[model samples]
Target: MTVEITGIILMFLITVLFAYPLGKYFSKVFKGEKTVTDFMNPVERFFFRVCGIHPDESMNWKQFLKALLTINLLWLVYAFFLLIFQDKLPLNPDGNPGQTPDLAFNTAISFLVNCDLQHYSGESGVTYLTQLFVITFLMFVSAATGITALIAVLNGLREKTTQNLGNFWNIFTKTITRILLPLCIVGAILLVFSGTPSSFDGKDSLTTLQGDNVQVSRGPAAGMIAIKHIGTNGGGWFGANSAHPLENPTYLTNMLEMIMQMIIPLALIFTLGFYLNRRKLARVIFGIMTIGMLCLVIPTIISEIGGNPAIEKMGVSQLTGAMEGKEVRFGPAASGYWSTVTTIISTGSVNSMHDSSMPVSGVMQMLGMMINAFYGGCGVGLLNYLIYIIIAVFISGLMVGRTPEFMGHKVEAREVKIATLVTLLSAFLIKGFTALAAYMVAHHPETGWAVQPANWLNNPSYHGFSEMLYEYTSANANNGSGFEGLGDNNIFWNVTTGFVLLLARFIPIIGPVAIIGLMASKKFIPESPGTLRTDSWTFGVVTLAVIIVINALSFFPALALGPIAEYFSLK
Candidate 1:
């Protein structure tokens, strides 16, 4: 328990130290004020000339918003086609086709919306070409979404005086082409070097321990892993998640994966601060996120380290840690960290089986997903936090009997409504779908579905309920990481859960961005005595509270059936 707490603290301190300078660099990228801007200037001008665009003309809100909407729609259509005809395409080693209609729709929407849900293993159902196509396309769209939103926010700032349409496009393109893509490329190469496979060949024959021939699933795994972390898309090329040696491979790959997973989200905070010309505001948001991360992670480590005494009495060695569903190479510390990171960011990638985690550890991961997964990707996380910050600052105003303001902007009714909606949407999806899944698990047994003795249904109690609730929460949050105990590939999971993926992902992005667009339209309000300085700890506590209340109300009953029951029944 003590060691886990120490590791949790170390992770926090390390994240802060590493995150600050990275944020500084991203700030330069967003502001378009760095020395690199000079190098990009001529190239930018040449493109403008080629396209017959004037370098001096700024883009208005309408133009920026239009470009965002159009690009996403196009990506959605393309991804849908590719997913639907995946069987007809090449690289499927297992010779699987798109059998289920709902699965096809679910997968298409998942990748389109940047959610990347995986019901089957990638190496089995998908060809190498398909894997590469999905990976590359996802990286582009996910990175583009982040970069575009950021550009909008930056342009919104400039809209106060100048809305350079050319400048906005130039910034957006440069960030995607120059920064995001190149970084992902380098990250991918490093992952390959760390032993993650990057190949296009079909499955290879392998001799199993039982002297049986097995077809080893293979694909463009390394290529996908690079952007997977960069874009914060957690889907893996293999169904074992990151636990498979070929997928994660080595310690160096593990570290790289961790860094890549978090780098963008952390860096964007600095970018946000630098763009707003208020480092303090960025720190407040980052600090709040960091604290939330620790609150979840600390207990997770403790849950794993403390071990289950009942299991130990059966001669299971606690010293080896909770080995069930965890990779031997990653061990407790690394696996626990990865779980926390994936859950917090909405990445949903796993190096371990989340279901097999100790009851309390599992609960901690769930709480993080329900709370902070809002600011999940690069641009989205900070933007989501910003909306909440505005509201928090506004509330702080009334408490002290003063007008609350954020970054010289007043928190008006519209902003408040938008923030509330965005925050509540995830909660609604998680709870609503959870209820739906519970109704199924309870009703399914009554319908005489054959139940295997070893299945989650064997318990016919809270454990069974836990399996269903976990599946629902995992799907709806777009946190594709799963409990692994439920038979969710049935028609019920395919259709209802797919709906959760769409809502969880698209709603959060569009909702907050609309608020950003709205915020852009308003003139910056000057700070006065009543304006709350959100950088303080008091506001941080409130921000944390807001997240907790939302999750508690939404997931309280389901969690009680799941982890709460497991914890109490352990004795």
Candidate 2:
């Protein structure tokens, strides 16, 4: 237990160490200041020239969003068709078939939104061409899309008043060329050297030591795995995800993947400080997020390491804790930590099956996604936190006798409305969708879809409710991890969650960026003696309180019916 605890601590600390400097580097790259990867300037220039975009041209918030939506729509159309007809494409060494239309819709939108929720397994869902061209390609671009939006919002905040945030095309291009590509190349090389497959060779059959024959699946997985972790895009190259030996390989790879998933989200927070010259504010935000993270992670580790009490009554030894759905190389403690980290950051990649975890651990995992901003995903983490910050700023002002202001601009009714709507929108999508799924299970079980609603869940009653709730929460949070017990590959789940992915992924983004833009256009009010110090510990406490209160109000009831009730029932 002590050794396992130590490993988790070291993994977290190492991620922090890497994130700080990388964050600084990211700010430099965004600012166009000279850095190690300045050699990519020519390549960026070539792309801008080919696309006929002037890198220096700035855009208003409306123009920025329009371009973002337009390009994304085009990408969606392109990917959907290719996935539908993947069997006709090249790179299918195993001759895998194309995806059904509904599944293709889910898979395409899932990747496009940075959600990466796989209703279909990676090995046989589509061919290698689609995996590389569609899946791997979207992993890079979707992550860059999130980071680019973060930079754009930061631009709105940093200036006292400015109509133009940076150019979307420019920031997006530079993010890929300088940050994501270089890191992925290095990460892919490490994985390839460490025994993960990087070839296009088909499956090879081999007899087990017991003389049982089986065909093993392998592909160009190392590269996809690299982006999957670093980009926080969590669809796996194989069905078992990181739990598969070929995907994770060893304890060292486990540690590496864990660190990669977190570094970008953490680094980007520090980059906010550098970009805005507001290091103090950044520290306060980081402190709050870390505390929130600890609240979720610590309980999870303890619960997982304690094993299942029910199993203990069955007279089975559980000295190593609950090992039911976990890799032995990465025990319960590390698996618990990964579960917390992935859900919190929207990575959704799993080293173990979440369904096999204890009830308390399930609560923590769901809460992490419910709050959705503790550490968040690649670029979306900061964007989501920005929403909470605005709300906190407004509430703090109301408590005192001052007008709500963020940075220099006054936080008006407009900004507050947008923030409140975005917050409530998450609850609505999660609960509304889960309720619909539940109603279908209870009342319309014989509707006879691809998989009947009667067969949607493997576990009966309370545990079954959790599978449905967790799915929508994950969809709403844009976190792609699942309970694995849910029969969710049908048309109903695929189509329903596809639409959820679109709205949940974009509305929060649109809200924050719109707030920043609106505030930037407002009059800048200079700080006075009466002003609230947003960078102070006091404001940080208020911010954390607001987050806690809102999460409780928004999610506690639904949670009570799911994991919380299930915990006591098990007792």
Candidate 3:
């Protein structure tokens, strides 16, 4: 095995160790355990009193679910209205036009739900009010959804111990006030310093790119980009995306952006272990994530190291590595590393164009999207991982000739069914939609929505198929990273992609939240010889097998059609 691949396997083992403590901590916070309370109790009490919240009151799963859905729904409405009313809004630059109805609806749900599916240009059309609304409503809701997921998990933890999770109001207030808002504010400040535009003026700036005095469009870039990452949202303020210097100016800024995108998802795992009082479970999940990351890094390094054939044909000495569509400052190694990591974690921001990558490297990128979109999104990354944990528990139970239990919670038919549903939904949505899109594009050239000819070469190169597979997978998985060669902003793409985003995301979230609620209500079993220690080596192998097999099997046919087909064609 390659070093990167080996690293990935090792990383999984390390992640397993980390996850247990993290999950334990997560459970601890929700249950108001002594360790977490000793530190956060004073803060919680002070804030609850100041904000007039009843910390003692708790809500059931149904109530929690309702509030979570309602908040997101309202935010969606707000995002839609803002997009529709952009021209009339205060933030409009002097000459920009308003959005059409279909476009507005698509964009609203896309942003509010953290879908990142945009059909419109950011620089030319949006006014100040539109940008502000996107920042205020869409970004806020994007971050809010993460908060809601955490609250739901906490509720599950509380139910297991005290029969009451924290109240929705209290949880929401604390999460936003303490965690989301603070991170966003700090992130925004750092982004501004790094040169992401901080202006509301719709006026275009005069800039000489490659020497011509062209007009560079500006908006509330810093404000949006901050929460964009903090919320694990992948939307770019401009078409150039993070590849643009203005959006991602410095090395320091880039690192910060990457770290912030990952922090909450990782932290949530610790929270889970803490609440359950089973550090081992969290470690196993963490191990899986780390292993996934290690897998991501290797192919990326190899691809980058392989360099570009087309570039080589140009008589340029390929000094370092793959150069096409990648930043020289960050280089292929860093770009490849980030690409894999982000896809696995559900943060789809890219520093390089994935479309131009080498075939094998591109395959790994595709794989990450498969893992993320189907698994869970953003803060829900670990939640989806938890589903796999349940599967591991179940399989381990079978091995031991006993019923499987996780953290003393049983893995019954309903729980496994829901978990399975959650895993398969995104795969189905992605592959089915990709096939549909391919057919539509082939049959309807007049739609002007076909894959780019350059991207859809006659050859079956892994790179070519990766670009094709990436489009639907990214949409279906809701990762939002593209090979950058797809025409996804047209009527067909807009509507189809928008539907995939909504259904793929909300439905999967509902599944895990429901499972967590059910598990929380059940009684915890004491550890015994019959109990399968999930943190053990035997369990880890089973966990890895389940995740690897599920993703490989689910995406196999689609992968063959897209990347594999293209690879063979190339040969």
Q: Highest TM-score, which number?
A: 2
Better of 1 and 2 by TM-score: 2
Kindly give the stretch of ten consecutive residues in candidate 3 with the minimal lDDT sum.
452-461
Evaluate all candidate structures by whole-model CA lDDT and list the values in order: 0.69, 0.92, 0.68
lDDT, candidate 3, residue 9? Answer: 44
Top-lDDT structure, candidate number: 2
lDDT of 2 by residue, 503-559 (tens): 999998889889999899888899998889999988988888988999999899998
Deviating ranges (above 4 Å) for candidate 1: 1-18, 35-63, 91-94, 157-171, 208-211, 373-375, 444-460
Candidate 1's residue-wise lDDT over 395-476, tens digit each?
Answer: 6767788766555555678878877887777777777777665665555535443432234342356666766666666666
Clashing pairs in 1: 58-163, 58-164, 58-165, 59-164, 59-165, 91-127, 91-128, 92-127, 375-381
Rank the candidate models, highest lDDT first. 2, 1, 3
What are the runs in model 2 whose C-alpha is more than 4 Å off? none
- Per-model TM-score versus the true fold: 0.89, 0.99, 0.86
Candidate 3 lDDT score relative to the true structure = 0.68
Q: What is the lDDT of residue 132 in candidate 3?
A: 65
Ten contiguous residues minimizing lDDT sum, candidate 1: 449-458
> How many clashes show up in model 1?
9
